[model samples]
Target: MGLRHKKASAGGGHSTSGISPNSTNGTSGTSPDISENRPSWRRDPLEYNLDRSWDINAAPTTRVFNLTSSEIQAAPDGVLRPLFVINGQFPGPLIRVNQGDRVLVNVTNQLSNGTSMHWHGFYQNGTNWMDGTVGITQCAIPPGESFLYDFTVKQFGTYWYHSHFSSQYTDGLVGPFIVHSPEESKIQEMYDYDQVVLLQDYYHDLSAALLPGYLSSGNENAEPLPDNGLIQGTNFFNCSSYDSDSGYACDQNSTRAIFNVAQGKRYRFRLINTGAFGEFQVSIDNHTIQVIEADSTLVHPVTVNRLPIHVAQRYSILFHANQTTTNYWFRARMNDYCFSDQNPVLDTDVRALITYTNSTSDPAPTESVDWTYALDTACEDLAPSSLIPYDPLPAPQVDITYPIEISFQIGDFALDKAYINSTTWVPPAIPTLNQAVAGLQVNNANFTTSGVSTAFDSSQLVIDVPTYKVIDVLINSLDEGAHPFHLHGHQFWIMASGAHGAFNWNSYPTLNMTNPMRRDTITVDAFGWALIRFKADNPGLWALHCHISWHMEAGLLMQFQTRNDIMRGWAVPSDVLALCHVK
Candidate 1:
């Protein structure tokens, strides 16, 4: 099945409105009139929530969203720089829909560079071209052009959309995409309010300006450090930290994000880490949070004082407003131990205000005490074994095993690059999907291979599944840094993971096949290994790569061509094909 483009205008579907602070009982009341004339960075908190009158059991309808990408100057953390924003918002607007609803997003690229929008964690089963991956699915939406991303969301949980071209998303161009389902009715009752909490590692310079240095010879594997951390795209940065002649436009008027909650009400905060490099250890002072979902996979509630979240990963936690009516600190501390080098001007501890009375005052140190538990010293995800899927679904028996090793090497010109089994991926001139469909339709032998395909150049790592089967991917990281790997179009059951060493063949039979944590993104610890299994049921060219903006740009990516029997019949939409031929 190919993607369908609708010719209707961009404003008819359910649109979001601002949340009124005067509302009681956690239900939104009298939405404030929001328009383009308002401050660009200001977003309505209610825009992130499912409408109170929305009927979860109602029929799914097509939701149309319009986004304009442009370059603007803004100081998310006191440092002014050129940023790529959607609809003038640093963090893009929310695209909320119900499960099975067709989502049509019109992305108008006004920047001088090419761009594409990847809906993170969506199973773009039949509409693979709409996956919006630059190299694996389709070409980038060229400068001053528009592309309509059309796909139906099959899963319901917290997901996001971001630019898939190079490190463009690091500069901005990211936002939340949420899908609600009737199946969530039971979980909905557990909370009276719902909102999104965006956590990102902020950089003072544009990613385009920093890329050359990181990719320069002799630089080794030292990733550029973040200047600050942000909560909801805003944070307090001390302008005095910069020298008077530092050449930066620092504004001391910047402030931290504040989230207000009513007493005795439970709120669900869906946290998404949209950063380039840093992993955040998130916590709310005096609040013991319960994690209900991870990477769009709902799980049995796991309570913890702090949450360790890596790049591109998401978690939804339930927080109860049972404490005193006062402001408390919500902390997202970057794991500096994971950084290869220290940044002197960086404040690793990023904070936001969580108030019960809508007071914006900073919490007194003695009023809100942090949990005594030590932060995570290692860069990795929360243990997979500790989280069990809410719905018990046994993993299918594995039919094959594919082992791949990852490492960063300084080769040739002494420039550093990442590799997956001796192959460092670079975007092919034509997307892999285009090449596969064209070759498969003509019965080319190179495209029909069961293992790795030779239809593309050496830089393209293409593993062809070709048929339906259950597969286990053993990902062993040889480098000394944690990597959060995201698999497009599918969520896998994490059979086993370790901080160090190889998968034990002796322990293979003892693995948990029933109800293991299933998620779209997982962090393989530094020099660690992870064995994940998934059924090769989705027909398309699916990308499996590290979600870190730096790592991915360094050639750490691969694609799986699954179920060619169905893909062989695809006819890519003309609009998607037109992007490649743009002058």
Candidate 2:
């Protein structure tokens, strides 16, 4: 286990017996009456039409090589302003499958550049080849080639897939992969109403939303271009202003998701933040939200003053509507870009807004019982325990317990937001790139793609098979903003984070608890450090870095792996494995 000290936001309000993300004012607010008067919004208006069929010749595609936003939407007003996209769609189609279903994802690459698809958080059990681990798992899918992706759905939850070979993920190569329930996904869990919003950000021009552009192509002196790293993929009819026939002049990568809800009903809103860079304190037309689920696992259900979702993470919430006649405009108006730059052009953050149907004004709030908050619980915090027995195999094991300090030197408001690791990381897309950019060095090793393995080399998502245990990861901030640090696969407990200029190690409530907020990803406050711990349990390559879509694409990633578990008897069936040419 890697045990390290992290900085934390010490004294925030807890959810238990308190205000959940669902209601803003809390117990004092009047609750909604579910007795009678069912309006149309109470009938679950948010329905997603998802269809899954067999496509024979589709490989991993990236649009950065040629196409622009204009080609995808095909309308002067329809353009989504995508920088890097696959199939010209941001957050690709919602792929539907069932458990135990052997699916064929025929990927057809359209870009001139090579790319690969990595199904984020998809436990590649028997089909190791399907893991898409980039260098370790398979080679990049070249342009104009077709790669047959065959794998069975083993787990169910809200997961996604995107390009790992390049920065295509930030552009829009990824999409939702929904593993339907055994009932064929017919049993719709309606809260009277439902909604889904995928929060994303795009650079004005060549932010991570597009490929490397000229800058990332090893061009250090390239001229910077305009870019706004803020965006959400689809357009909707809520607080988002759009010209029905003739639209307003918004940025190139702007689209809004709209939800029309009637008053006095329970509404389920699934919130997924896939933005390149933007941590939000989301508000839905001033309505508080009850956060029921995180990532894919069900939490104890905590209400929050804000629906704070970073990149590559998902949260499901229940909203109890209190009105029905008027338009209740919901908005995730971006609170602050943690990486804010003075240049407003490049800071076109993707703000979220939802329009609801409101009824006669009672101004009466809803009283909510059955509310739960706090991530640390008995079930979620527990490690993977085997109800069944298992056989073991030989593997390397190294336990490390050293202090690794990572400093984030905060800069001025305008320049500080542009936190690219290197001048190269800015790509040519950055307008007036940060020239005195510090070289990316991880564990004090200067990272280089030349294969000499730099200290900042995110080369390995995993440390070679149980090679190092007891690793200490410490990210310190020399500034005053918050930064979220995420580790893949393994959820680490926050040992300590500095808030109020000191570490409340002993006073920290959930440090050693029977129930801890079991999370694989967590946000580190701006200008602070966050320490997390995790067991090197899972044996595969994994990434440790910022969940911010733009950050990872900008070289803020490192990898390690645990190989002690070779997965005995976990072999692909002869028939299924034969799909590939064995020579």
RMSD of 1: 6.6
Candidate 2 stretches greater than 4 Å from native: 1-90, 98-103, 126-129, 152-154, 180-190, 208-232, 235-256, 345-403, 407-462, 465-481, 493-510, 564-583
Candidate 2 is scored at a TM of: 0.61
Per-residue CA lDDT of candidate 1, range 143-176, in tens? 8899988888788989999999999999999998
Relative to the unseen true structure, what is the C-alpha lDDT of residue 247 in candidate 2, on a scale of 0 to 100? 35
Q: How does model 1 score by TM-score?
A: 0.94
What lDDT score is found at residue 154 in candidate 1? 85
Taking every candidate in turn, the Cα RMSD to the unseen true structure, in Å, is 6.6, 13.7
Instruction: Give lDDT tens digits, candidate 2, residues 1-583.
Output: 0111222220112211210112122111111332132222111112132222212122222211122111132211133343445444444555544445555666766765655676665656556556654443455565666566666666555666677654556555655565544332332343554345556554334343243442243332122222333223543222134345533335443233334455566666666666555544455545667765565555544656455566667766777767444444344434333333333333332333333422322222342111233222110111211001111211222244323333332333312222323211221211110100112212222322222133323322223333335443555543344445666555554555553243444554444433334445656554445555656655444556655543444444555544423422233334323322322
Candidate 1: deviation at residue 484, Å?
0.3
